[model samples]
Target: MDTPLINALEALKKENRISFHTPGHKKGRAYESMDDGGIQENLYQYDTTEVFGTDQLQDPTGAIKESQQWTARVFQSPEAYYLVNGSSAGVLAMILSQTKPGDEILLPRDVHQSVIHALILGDLTPRFIQPEIDPQFKIPKGITLPQVQEGLEKYPKCKGVLLTHPNYYGRPGEIREIRRMTREFGKILWVDQAHGAHLGLHPQLPLSGIDAGADLTVTSFHKTLPAMTQSAVLFAGGEVVDRERLLEQLNMHQSSSPSYILLASIEQGTRHYAKAGKEKMQVLLEAIESFEQKFRRLGLFQLDTAPGKDRTKIWIHTENSGRTGHEVETYLRENHGIDMEFSMPQGLLALTSIGNREKDLKKLYLAFEELEETLYNKVKMEKFSEKYSKEAKEGFFEKEVERDKKEPLGLPIRTAFYSRKERVSINKSVNRVAGSAVTPYPPGIPLILPGEAITRGHRDQLLEYEKRNIKVIGIKAGKIMVVAEE
Candidate 1:
């Protein structure tokens, strides 16, 4: 793996350059990482300031440019840029660069919290394409072409659509059809492919966003690939996205001093994918197949292999097996020393990649086998959801839906974000115009957004989530910020 970024860092460090750099570390001499048991010496050496050979990340001219070009080539993207600040930065950058405040951007309701933040920063009006919620898994499936068509038709002034190729639950969407429609309608297509970074690597994978002709596709390489956390890549697929403006937006969000270690990891991951992605993915697929066959016979767990879903992620539903997603997660962690990707209310998502070890998976199977016996011998148990919310006959999410039916947008999102607001208790927050997003952080989905009229039901749901220890952002010190009364 030829990492130009790492090579530059190593060569610069080997030369033993003197002081007089923006970074106060001065080549990790004064940094306590060397003395104390902090970051390794190699990281300190590699973590250099943007000196002569070390190219600037904002305006990549040398190694960064070369590395990104290789990345583009490997991914078959027209143009690509490194994102050190994760896909969150990429999502924000795309929205900021392409759409202006008050512009309408149609998207699915189940988007990441970062998208909500981006909507706020851009002050863009969001027209949500109602996602088909999976009855079995309770997760929102990706938007279809018909939904996109309806959104566009409903919101005539909508500039573009931001589609999440694969929802966090490993459900993929109709990217190719959506792309074709976006082109036909002369609308920009931004695919938030935070989970599809390794899509093109294997033939078994679903359609890659760039190949599907998305205007702008941003991927968090760390999510599914062997890249370091916070490592991501942004692509300018079509003429819709202005490359220079995208770069400018990236610079606005990205750190002035980017991490060489993360940049090098991105390069290395790309190189690895180019070399052995197919073979590795095949092995992973085979292993998963074997695992599934064995698990299916056990008659305990259920898998979500719905159409258009990613094969790399194993979505295990333990409802029939008498286990909650969190219980399964805890068992897998404490009993088997295996931490799953995420545990939703319906099921647990186990992330398997080309990099996953066979022995580790085998161990996971053994753990499941143990879990079956343990659960089998045990008496009847109450469901986690059932244990909570004695008052609400419907499930927690159903209550949320009932709340959402209360009212519509109070004002434009742009106006609401910029308006003078006051903090109020959850009880008093009803009928007040929301000044910010109230989101569930784990899934990173916002329940309510700025300018939306907060209802009593919405407040109750927020309180329930808080009581359950689930993080609800935008509520500070038992108060929610909302637009003040004139």
Candidate 2:
């Protein structure tokens, strides 16, 4: 049979690779303990449209509404809605419902690409608050109270604020404080908690956005919960959100025919969360702690840590060992049959969930132990030092420091996005208006946004990413899309 994707997936399944990645069911093992009423066993049979028994997702009145109500109760939100289109639709709805066209909204510059799409679709202007960067990981953390205070004070007439809690690397910021500030200023607070569905499941984890008093919050069930892909939930609470307007945007952004299978999986996932999430989370955390303690005893590995970082997400750094994360990731896959969530220049990330078992952590620890033992006797790898020079490293971090200073926007996001564009080399496009966003996937934060004026710093950082062979979305054959001049 000429089934390329299915064949590959089946082959990989046969390989029994250890997963520290998403679609958080760990290859459907979570379903084994779930009380799914045969939904997991007969997924094909359950695939159907809105019929007599099935209620409409947009205007839920029957079973769907009941399910969502149960979910809201479980998550401690005032009202909850299921989304088959993932958190992207929920993010768009949040923006469109809160503000009108040409109105300005305050948000972090490190927002997911969906936030930029919302700006384009709503014909709105953005007042970006730069997020603080982690000095060790070189990844953006979360918005601070001072940054938000400055943005709101500078753009006093801005409609509201949108924030991404636990920004991709699992470090949460001051959502509680920011929520209070927004209320005092009579502004709405919307949270993109796409990677924090497991929060509040355990006492040790950081507070969930809903619990932090966000007026609106969107969480992806698939990211850290035992839900199928594209399954998510949006919560509406507090006094700021316009309920009627939010419902309108929900319908506008979501599909007319939502997936029944996805809905079933969400319901089943929610059931698991309600039943066994805490117990299993405790087990998973203990396992991870044991793995960390064991690996740290090896005396040759480094683990990334922050004050409020999620313990479920582990980052293994090879900088001290003189190997790039990309190199270590390749070695793991080829030698240890393990897959990670993502790899950066500094380290590889492993996203754990309730679905992960103790054995999984044991496997990871064994792999790292073997890697260190095997490489300890050999001469130190010079590729990292040769490739990343001291001057280049300084420039890379210098670009991050420069992000604290606001760059000029050449045109409004909506106008620049719809305008005609021409392809130009990355270096030649500096100071010209960007026609599209240059974003890296996995973390999905845009380095350059549409309608923003390109700077020499942007050019140098992107060039460095290219030299490191990172995958960026907007560049093709070394050319970038810039708005054509008259």
Candidate 3:
């Protein structure tokens, strides 16, 4: 009998679209481009389960152990563990290992949704550090050193500070200064280095979290490195993380029957980086620079050139082209057959890596050039209203006012989460404790987190959501969730 899964795989192979998306190796060229035929064949052969030669992932004392050691050496970390689960697991493990319930942690507002989930699961109190916002681009920038200093001062008893380095948009923060601030405050600096797996390979690239004095850092190998999906690494610095506790936490979160394919892919990807990552990345950077020039000439989309941003992760704002990022993304996928990483309301992101070929990028440049010629003259660019953008910015800060209050919503998150919550009208929910997190997904910082009392400003933001027809979760048809009690 023909299986549907096999049929889907065959269909995917038939499409043969250029992937400007993930797994780093766009078209399996890294493996196919190998000089040694025997090595390439062996690579494919060992991509199997825990068979005769291949050992189990959890109790790795053979090839997997060796691979982990090599990875640690390459990244210059004291110890590293292969994360069969993505860096999300590693982030949760690290946080759970260190702190207990009621322990306060300072988190950057721009942190990934996974971190927020960890906070909820661990029942940890979170004090947010607002990252600088680039109003012109409508993108949040990195956490400033002063912000870290201020957070530590404000929450002197807080257990740790969690940061997302080289944020999703690829903006790198001043790690050295932030490290100094954390050290002075005697707080463990846990870094979410998910988007920076390849940083250690090239010195010219942004500094790796480990080098910047992070206590524990997690890297998603599949993001910028040539690893299989869900393969990541958790790195620990000297005398910072408790090894025994970390191992126990890993066991708690990680799978018992971890995928051998993902574990082995970590080894192969690390080896590839150690051998030729810098050289390959240099070549890729050069190609990207040339492509940016070509796109500028076409005037299709304007690239975001914020200082210290990752050159490889190209972000292009298409609002000026009379199209939303979603429209451009749909056009590229359906018409041009080009797949991208993500498309925000404001812009589209095309992620490049060492594994991308010259031919692949040429296709992207050519496609954009043709698209520009066809649409630029016909479509009049709509100037995005500064008023709407300003209101959104003001709304974000207004949410923070409730978050910072001394008796802010005075209820435990878990208690509120699983409690007999009732749906109340947005206006009626004013001054009532929130039973959920309601915020924009791209930034993902909650405007109304569990236990935070809703205010008029909160009501205003929610009303704006209704005006724009944006879906608000944990609410019944525009009604907000509040504690069922009086």
RMSD each, Å:
9.1, 2.4, 4.8
Q: Write the residue-wise lDDT of candidate 2 on 1-486 in tens digits.
A: 699999999999999888889989988877667656467778888888899989989899999999999999999999998989899999999889988998999998888999999999999999988777667666677788999899999999988989888777787878889988999999988899998988988878878889988999999999899988999999998786898899899999888999999998888878899889998899888898888888877655687667778889888866565556777787778778888888766667888898888988898888888778766765444423455435435454456456545587888888999999998999899899999998876677788889989998888877877887889999999989989999
Model 1 per-residue lDDT tens digits across residues 165-270: 8877778889999989988888999999988887887676789898898989999887777666788999888887877789899999999989988887677668
Q: Give the winner by TM-score.
A: 2
Instruction: Score residue 67 of candidate 3 by CA lDDT.
Output: 77
Judging by TM-score, tell me the better candidate of 1 and 3. Answer: 1
Could you say which candidate leads in lDDT? Answer: 2
Error of 2 at 458 (Å): 2.4
Query: Deviation in angstroms for 355 in model 2?
Result: 0.7
In model 1, the clashing pairs are: none
Candidate 2, position 246, lDDT:
90
